[model samples]
Target: MPEETAKQTHFYSVEAPDGSYDLRIEEMLARIESTAAPIYMRLINGKIPEHQDKMDMAQFLAVMVVRTPGSRKDAAEMVGRMIQIRNYATGVHDRAFNSLVHRIEQGEGRQLTEESRTSLRRSLIDPSGYRLELGKEWALQHLTAADKLTPVLFQMRWRTIGAAQGFFITSDDPVVRWVEPKTWHPIYGDHGYLNKTAVVTFPLTPKVMLAMSWEDEGANAFAGRQGVDRLNRLRALQADEYLYAHLDHEVIRRMAVATKGSRPRMTTEGFGPKKFAATTLRRGRANRPS
Candidate 1:
């Protein structure tokens, strides 16, 4: 894949001196809501020229909900759901573009004329530049993860889920096992794995948080404070069992401070009934990749 274009932008930090959490929330909410309105209108009017407008709306809402002060835990959960929706929307856009190109090719009954092909390619790729720049700005402004400990804690949750589920849930591999088999007492023997067994099967909510945190911190820290590079170092340190165990306690403490009063709520149901497995099996039988 081609490297994504370089982003040029900056996000102002919002630090209210009174330390009143509600005030902070209200300010951020106002900013997001105000920014989102015009974008939403543009989308509704069909005046925006690209899919980036749609993505900007999704991302803006995600930031707004996550930054809203209620329960940090709830906000985190909401952010996770938002990320999943954004990922799904991006996938749908890609499929639609591909389908359009395929139909055009079919209609032509031959390869596309060079000029036509160039136009189609430009139509598909040009808009991503603006979207990525906007996304970077939003992430820097509102998607911060509190502090350094937050990323480690987020990673812990991911690791725990993967361990309990018995396969790497966030890997890009398509054939990894995701769900484990168990007999529910109520069912008296009914058992099967839950979601598709594959890397990248689920949205990388924790990773997104960590990445955002890194960006925020990197942007804010003083020169020589070691910024996002510091995050990379922490990840390396986490590989050491003693280091990780020691830091885990710190992460829990910080999360308590950050997430205070928020309880884990299931944002959405996990992928239902392993339908993807059947599709994958069929593709295999047909000697095709899913």
Candidate 2:
């Protein structure tokens, strides 16, 4: 029993801001649904309004697809696009937000104002009030890119927090600063060497954090690992395809079962320098003995 218990690992309990994760997600979903419902109703009723731009409607539909449960990254990109569109549609009262949004929208990126940049830094590090989805690669890319533009602000925020409290797990490699190098894998055999991928830990705050292992190599194989089963199940249902064919009935059934409940609070574990050093010493002594 002691051995069994020792092998069982536990993560930290990190609650979302004000315990409002569900409320926030629900609000985002409702807003997206409201935006899309009218378009769907028009299509269902066969009221083909001539003024309705199919292209715009298609984009809106894409937005809807991304917002559905388990579509975090897609939703985040769609939301980013939506934010851009809104900025364009509504003239900005503050020149700062408008400028930053315009530069991002245009290929020509611009420098962020100290105040606006500070806010973005806080958003990237905390990621609480900000609704950008972390599950998607594109969303992570955007967040990373945004952070780069305001490195000073980000560094300042990081420094304010204790060293052990940040989201990323530092490594010897510099590339690990962005996304984990190990996460990048070769898509094709002839594509050349693959990079080392690392698991990125996204800390929500003092307690809650989510870790995602992004890799270019053997994504399918990695997804099969037990730790990622729940996430993979959700993604499979959303994707609706396995290799070439649709999922087996049993797989679909399992996926449905897995996703039936409400979203649970994220889990965090304290595995810092202290824990690492302690574990290493214990293993060394055990190995040295007869």
Candidate 3:
């Protein structure tokens, strides 16, 4: 992707000049709400079969496409596994987590402790032109061992026919912002295996949040609408149907694999009285590669 293009759309707006939820996702939210409790549950729980979270852009939208609730509760289970890190990189997922020591004498409401805040700002956020993206170094020193103790691969597939990572936002406003925190949870009905699954979190914009494959882990990743192009990219996706269709499946797959791991497998009810393996992508989930 062109650096210029990425820059323009990375930021997102939550409101319009007239001040209503951005229309692009406004209708999407209504769908989620109207889809009934079950569809809403599937909307943000897990994107793929194996890896529950650290969901990339494509996986999240694919969940939104499911407008109807399945006949059974267990039918929502998704599955898969992944492994595609480059040789040049050990992968940010692999590293000895480092501890940080900071004294937060004071802090504002719902923010990190003052001391931790100072360290993050000085080292990560304050740097000129920095977006505070998480890297291996950031992971080692800042992020501790999340719920999972070690590195894990994630499952991924791109069935949607647009830019796999982004969607349109119907906001005319020049700016939009919202706070997102990373969290993880043990896969809900995993029986036993997926006790330590990666929580699927994605870039926000509730449409995005509702689509989150939420795990119980406390929020860690903090997303802000500071990037220069957050707004443009959202609207651009809204307008460019053909552009969205041009997807890089390979990269998206690798991304899903590199970023996280799968949850415990479950059993889902098939079309009727018989229940098939839940790990299968029959629950409104599909992909080119399992």
Candidate 4:
């Protein structure tokens, strides 16, 4: 709905007989924004959020995490991967195809003609090349997952970093999950959102950003030039396609150049974003650059 490009498209839309899909999600998002607007204004005005504000903000962040194009594409890719695995399952694919061929022959009370059999065989094998379309169920699954993740995010220590000199930029996939490289394992593969060292960052505004971590110390602080630049770089790399900022600055241009080809991409063929690994100081105070 945010006009980044000339194209306009619907959000959270799905085909349903009762029209509940669009109505329900639209109403829910409306309510969330209605409650969150005050908190957003408070933050922009440099006021610390109260307990209720944090709760509402947490839910908003959780929904944002699941409601983006990147997230939906990721879900679609997962569905495609599951289908691919099922199609290529050991012995199962062949057995199923053969069984279908046999059933066609039996149902017609005669062997299938060569042309008919060939067509059937091709149809059976075609799924291997097909990518599964994510249905309404995927939306439900992501919303449920976000519901579970909200409490965990709320429990983490939160701090707001104001960009004093430089400004912060956001992207299509603005919420970034950074896994501490020291604790990262290739086998595990970026699998820790609840981990003590995991850092989740969201840009509240060009001048303010929010950070959640278990090991960080500051509750509220200002980011120096280096800190703002580092966070902006992470955002640029995390973006799927579009980046948003108040101004078209040289810093943003530099970020585009510095993080070229690093934007996380999700494909229909089950390929996902390349894993991003880096270390950033939490609140620019707890960990100092050497």
Candidate 5:
């Protein structure tokens, strides 16, 4: 367990007995089905998020592929067009930085010191929110200058968290600063990453039970359906324990059976940080700033 927080969390190891786990997963499934928000209500899942099982854990990373519009019929031409547009945007933004600095110096009635000038330049290049997707090799393989669909690539970092409030896990960045990294990392490769093997985790918070399926293929892998969900919270356990001991625990039973398979992960890096398999990506709903 990561350092105990004010909210003390108990550990639930995947290596524990399978017989006991079956019944426990059932109870968790029952709790979530009756309490979690519906799929049509996903817009609000960000606030309350979704509940997850104790073992619903894996490290996730992602990148994007965007199709572009053109008639030149060559991959290079398509890439060139994108570069032109990006450069134009960068130039415009750089000018705005100069203007802001000019105003600050004028308003203060003093020229910017050398150190201040360096700081201003650094701030101009820092990522505003999430970093822009920048891989062109993958894009070139799927596109040509003649293709009208332009795919842009944005990479997502592998994130760890204490508890899953919902269906997705936010990265260890400035955005979701509350999540803590806790896991048994047998998968860490020589590069010191969790991208090598599948990991099971014990989330401190409850997680929703949802099914994920692919709706598109190839460059359209990002498209998928987020199924309905259920939660497994400590409070839910208490409420249901007394009410109905055996009243329809099928939902949870089914979920436990399904989870024994491989974890669903999303990433552009095929196989993993080390090519564990010849594959790439998983399905989930991720938020991006408009």
Candidate 6:
């Protein structure tokens, strides 16, 4: 490690060696996994998790939400946006000037003074130029977010459901937040973690799933083939990149094909006067699944 990095006190103490923070995060996650392991086994064996077990499981899921590659991607993008804003605030105008010049050359058909160009370029600058490659330092932010989200997850009504037929498929980004079609809106897109209609779901295994919702309708139920298929479709729609299952089946292929054009997407948009907003829609959740 560089002398400066060695002295930085953030994720791990200054006295700790380089990579200590990463190991610490891994060990923390491992501890949560170990705690949740028995709960998972109980659910798999057709037992309802105790209240304390539920809280442990909720913490496991909450931390899982922040630890995935998809979450890291979102965090990196957020940092890029913040850097762009910082640059703009600090009067870094080179990118904006280049963007304005390119637009003028591309026949925007506007005549403008240098002052006009200077003012207009701010709106035309490409945010991608400010992107950053984040490192393990981001683990602190993830841990804090996970800590805050645990209670919200614990407060929700949880259900441990079994699939009567067919299997559940999970993905690289697997924790899924879904809203009823009736409550969905084009602009809002309806996957907000706090949305009253939103139900967060995770497949515990090929035959069982854990679902948390604000509603009380579906607790501890067995989903039939149709229900299982519906849940699988949600998994397909929400997958970040890859899917996993115990068995290789044609259903997976079919799902991949069916949801190809409509996969969930997480994006940042409204780059101009509106500024950038991180939006999580059915096409994407901010953090991915287990």
Among all candidates shown, the one with the greatest lDDT? 4
Ranking by TM-score: 4, 6, 2, 1, 5, 3
The true-structure Cα RMSD of candidate 1 reads 21.4
lDDT of 4 by residue, 235-278 (tens): 88878777888998986987787776686554333332122121
Off by over 4 Å in 2: 1-18, 22-25, 49-56, 68-290
| Poorly placed runs, candidate 4 (over 4 Å) | 1-9, 17-21, 90-93, 100-140, 257-260, 264-290
Error of 1 at 41 (Å): 1.7
RMSD of every prediction: 21.4, 23.5, 24.4, 10.4, 21.7, 10.3
- Candidate 2 C-alpha error for residue 42, in Å: 2.5
Q: Model-by-model lDDT, in order?
A: 0.32, 0.32, 0.27, 0.68, 0.28, 0.68
Model 5 worst lDDT run, 10 consecutive residues: 57-66
What is candidate 3's lDDT per residue for 1-290, written digit by digit as tens?
Answer: 75656342201123333534334433544453454444324434433223323232222333322211221111223211111111112112123112222122223334466676455444321223322121111111111221221122122221111122343232222111122323232343332212333222222332233212223333322224432135334333222122121245453344334423222123433222122222222212122321
The TM-scores of all predictions, comma-separated, are: 0.20, 0.22, 0.18, 0.77, 0.20, 0.70
Q: lDDT at 184 for candidate 5?
A: 39
Candidate 6, residue 6: CA error in Å? 29
In candidate 2, where is summed lDDT lowest over 10 consecutive residues? 276-285
Regions more than 4 Å wrong, model 3: 1-73, 76-251, 257-263, 267-290
Q: For residues 108-192, could you state the per-residue lDDT of candidate 1 as single tens digits?
A: 7877776885566553333232221111123333345433322222221111011121111121111111222443333332222
lDDT of 6: 0.68
Candidate 5 lDDT tens digits, 228-276: 1322222122121121122345644454345432221222322211211
